[model samples]
Target: MTTLPASAHWQPALGGDGFVEGIDDIRQAIAIILRTPVGSDPLRPDFGSRVWQYLDWPIDRARPHVVRETVEAIRRWEPRVKVTRVVVALDAEAALKITAYFRLASSGPEISAEVRPK
Candidate 1:
């Protein structure tokens, strides 16, 4: 694992309708990650990761706005990182899932996160 330099602030470009909701969720997720304990037997590193993991695809499919919001939120939260991949499927069901890898400069190692629609 690598450690990235702390960001000065989050910066994201979001579409109009889903912007607020997405930003809020991203903020919440970041807070959760910040609060995670770093130890030998620590809990999940971040609540955002858990939230993403258990997100309901159907709901996101039904409401595409939510997925847009999430993407924007992530972009803003971590502007320095670049998205390595993205997957969107509408045929399976009313749901959306996004998995991303990122590279950061000025750090010990690269950091990445998978953001899923909830």
Candidate 2:
């Protein structure tokens, strides 16, 4: 069977200093975008999602904003994937539970990325 070229591309792993490839990289990328507060990166002030601003609001109120930010941020940062849906819910601990569903631009199966500020 032919190996998927997606496996060749990779990104630096979160925390602990390692690298991640394939879907893991994509997942990490989304997590990074959501976790980073805007303007935190001096070189790329607009590189992250604005969802953090709405994290304090009630889930019902924040859902749309969170979805918008998630979609926009992924569209801007990760051109390889086209986000199809974003799900925002409240965690048991009263934290945000965001999940973005997307399909690879190259025409593959849909995938999802769970995002949190941790």
Candidate 3:
């Protein structure tokens, strides 16, 4: 299990988006991973997630896909944490919203990040 660097645990200050250290950084990183389409990056073809493919798919049908894609991507890319749960839902606009819950692999409180993958 990888632990966040000592500075990272207390480094981030509140930003305009209300993101802080540990949570926001991890959240943002996960969001980026999920937003990126596999094979888009020329150098690392396998550095992204497949969640975006299901964007056009119906939410009910896409839920499992989102959950699976996110869990695996997080597991592979972010060694600092382990995904515990991923919830998929639709907003009033019918857009998809993915909320993921995870904790540091080295042990810590569970943290959740909500990402509306485009």
Candidate 4:
């Protein structure tokens, strides 16, 4: 996986959607990732009850397939245009970096990319 520079960022343009569209996309991506033979296993080592309870509602309601499709679409778009690496800041102090690599096929215009979190 390529290493993203610490300063990279991804800001989606979804005006006034209040994250609804973003969440939907995330759901599709998750679904596709989960369905892939190599990445399909669900995350384990469950969090403690308190933490789990805090996230239970959203986790229970998430649509995996939708998330998967959304991610697939993004990956497909990667090389067609250009995408910056994503950098996420946590706790107002630390940052998580991610990078994507692309591959193209002659038969199709679509590009495939894999984003790896670092």
Candidate 5:
């Protein structure tokens, strides 16, 4: 007997109507959540993280603030993972880097994702 894999959610794929499954679904979902500015969605005024507010500020100061907001937003919105830690840093040439460490709710495997704010 063969068992089929379970799909968590479906999201539109780039340039088409096809959708992605499983871990990719969560990754894309989280990316969209982080990129959207707070209050941009009238129906969900508090849907996004506050990272955009600090995007123009100095990286040293923005790091902690970004981490805090990202962690809080993830905890509130995304139920698929439990955030372990968030590390915000400035990459070479001063681009902001946000790395989040988390554990999958279903399989308990550790994962990390890099996020960029719009």
Candidate 6:
């Protein structure tokens, strides 16, 4: 496998290059997209989800809105995967927990990823 420069975050795999591929790559992309605030990237003003907006909102309202936005953004940006479900939860410390279920575009295998905005 070719070693690729880390795009959003550094993730080292055992006995493998730092390159992200297949399902893992999709997961990483989702994490980066979710964490990035909209308009943060001047080149792509709509490249990110709106999860950051709900960060300070009440949990009851924020949870559903965040989940909807997460699903919409992933579907729009990440065409390599078909999003099946999105779950939003708040931990005791008020941290957002986002879990997304999806299937690869080329293959039908189901996969899940968790994304928490930094």
In model 2, what are the clashing residue pairs, if there are any?
13-18
- For 1-118, candidate 3 gives per-residue lDDT tens digits of 5355554453333335333465667777888788889999999999989998899997788899889999999899888788999999998889999888999888989889898887
Tens-place lDDT per residue, model 6, 28-116, is 88888888888999999988988899988888889889989998899988888898888888767778889999998777867999987
Every model's TM-score: 0.31, 0.88, 0.82, 0.19, 0.84, 0.81
Most accurate candidate by TM-score: 2
Q: Report the lDDT tens digits of candidate 2 across residue range 1-118.
A: 5333457678767675557898898898889888888888999988887888997887788899989988999999998899999888877887789989999999898899987765
Error of 2 at 44 (Å): 0.9
Distance (Å) between predicted and true CA of 91, model 6?
Answer: 3.0
Ranking by lDDT: 2, 3, 6, 5, 1, 4
lDDT of candidate 1 over 1-118, digit per residue (tens): 5343344443332334322223343343433332232232255332222234324546545345444444454555455444444444433564454444445423334444443343
Full-model lDDT for every candidate: 0.40, 0.85, 0.83, 0.30, 0.80, 0.82
**lDDT (Cα, tens digit) per residue for candidate 5, span 6-110:** 674766754455676677777777777788888999999989888899998988888788988898888888898888998888777677778888888766777
Off-target runs (Cα >4 Å) in candidate 6 are: 1-17
lDDT of 2: 0.85
Q: In model 5, how large is the Cα lDDT of residue 6?
A: 63
lDDT of 1: 0.40
Model 4 misplacement above 4 A: 1-70, 76-93, 107-118
Q: Show model 2 residue runs off by greater than 4 Å.
A: 1-6
Query: How many residue pairs collide in each prediction?
Result: 7, 1, 0, 11, 0, 0
| Candidate 4 per-residue C-alpha lDDT over 3-118 given as tens digits, one digit per residue, 9 for 90 to 100 | 43333322232334222222233333423332244323455322111111112234324334323333443445322332222221222323221222222322333333332222
Model 2 TM-score (2 dp): 0.88
Model 4 — which ten-residue stretch has the worst lDDT? 46-55
Candidate 1: pairs in clash:
2-109, 11-76, 12-76, 57-95, 58-94, 61-94, 61-95
64 in model 5: Cα distance from truth in Å?
Answer: 1.1
